[model samples]
Target: MKLTILGSQSPYNTTGHNCPGFFIQDNQTRLMLDCGSGSHSLLNYPNDLQNLSIILTHLHRDHYNDIYNLQYSSFVFHNQKRIEKPINIFLPSTPAKIYEDILSEQNSFAKYQIIDENSSFKIGNMNISFCPTDHPVETYSIKVQNGNRTIVYTSDSSFSAKNRLVEFAKGADLLICESSLLKEHGFPEINSHLTSEQAGIIAKEAGVKGLILNHFWPEEPVQKYVDEAKKVFQNVIPAIEGLTINIPSIEKELDERS
Candidate 1:
């Protein structure tokens, strides 16, 4: 499978960066992880509108604002007969107001399904599952598996000893984790997000093959987040907008070859 960073900024979009969004594709499936602000403009449009599935971690504006744009695109495309079916969207059902708003506005262009920690489904060759995360709202961290390769996306979440995230993400080929702040920033006591170091700890404890850090605070230097994560886990990759990463790192590929 392939994971692409559509945008990595957090809270809001900035001068050259957009809010959190990611694109994942394998041979038979096309899935979008989030649709944050400014991410709509980066989508492949008519092409992506067809046979696409979306999953939202929570109702945070920065994580789902672009979904409105996608709704419009789906509407137009279906009207034009460019696509025969509505796009599938899987999202948390809590924070009732936001969920109701989305349901009310949803036309026949997109099919919305409620997802929780117990949710498990398949799309093409990919097997997808969810686990609740340490976030204020009903947030979930997602796991996608195709054959023996697995990828885990830890959406907005804070560090918690009781969080099932490490087990949910264990042995993943790639862990796309949110690192919303630098360690020096001193995460707020009522934390709902992870620092780069915290993200590294999760990666190390989970024993994931590789780590991709995302959900950046726009003001901080990207390299600083990477540097902090590398302290605990050396195989750290900073999430860059428009960069696509192949699962099963080159190391694994070499090992298989050997």
Candidate 2:
């Protein structure tokens, strides 16, 4: 599987990156995880959404403002071709109800279904599962497995509860985590966010192949964050715009190799 940060800036827009969108592709299948505000219009690849799916972390505006755009674009770009087919959305049962109420405002989202937490499901050739995370909203961390590799994503969450994270990300090939701040200042606010130190510890304990941090605060010192994460994780990466990662897999041998 391949990963790209569609957007990674915090709500503060410190570096002008988008809020929380990330793109994942494996073989011929594609999924946009947490399509933050204004991301759908940014997808210009050929047949981008023809076989695309969306996995939302929560309903916070910063994380979901682009959903309506995704729904509208599908209809408009396909010459108003309607989707009597439902979209698969993995989310918590409660917020899933709220999502239904919100999307019901428009006819476009009438058919979508929400996959409850702890349930395993398949998308194309991938097997995926969701687990609760420590976030203000009904948030979920995703784990995906396919083609001999597993990757996990932990969207905006606090450091208070991390057991679920360790369970979900255990032995993942990559862990895409949100390190929204540096550790110098304790983040004990109402809508708290994680720090680089916390992310480092999480990844190290989970024993993932790599740890990539994202959703950085705009004005936050980038070096401070990177340096802090590096202290705990040797393979730590501070997310940069346009960065891409390909999870490794073995190439098939030709019959001639015999």
Candidate 2 residue spans exceeding 4 A from truth: 12-16, 80-88, 96-98, 105-111, 189-191, 249-258
> With candidate 2 superimposed using the best TM-score fit, by how many Å does residue 210's alpha carbon deviate from the native?
0.5
Backbone steric clashes in candidate 2, count: 1
Cα RMSD (Å) per model? 2.9, 5.6
Worst 10 residues of 1 by lDDT: 249-258
lDDT (tens digit, per residue) of candidate 2 on 30-117 = 8778877655544753366656778888878788777777766655555545433334444444565668665564534323556557
Provide the TM-score for each candidate, comma-separated: 0.93, 0.85
Candidate 1: stretches off by over 4 Å? 106-108, 161-163, 188-190, 248-258
| Candidate 1 clashes between residue pairs 3 or more apart in a chain or in different chains | none
The collision pairs in model 2 are 14-218
Clash count per candidate:
0, 1
lDDT of 1 by residue, 1-258 (tens): 777788888888876688888898887578999889987777786887778999998999999998888888898889999987788988898899998888787554999999988899998889999988888898989899998999899988878732488999989888889999886997674377888988998999999888889898888889999899988988887877887776756346423422
Candidate 2 lDDT trough over 10 residues, lowest sum: 249-258
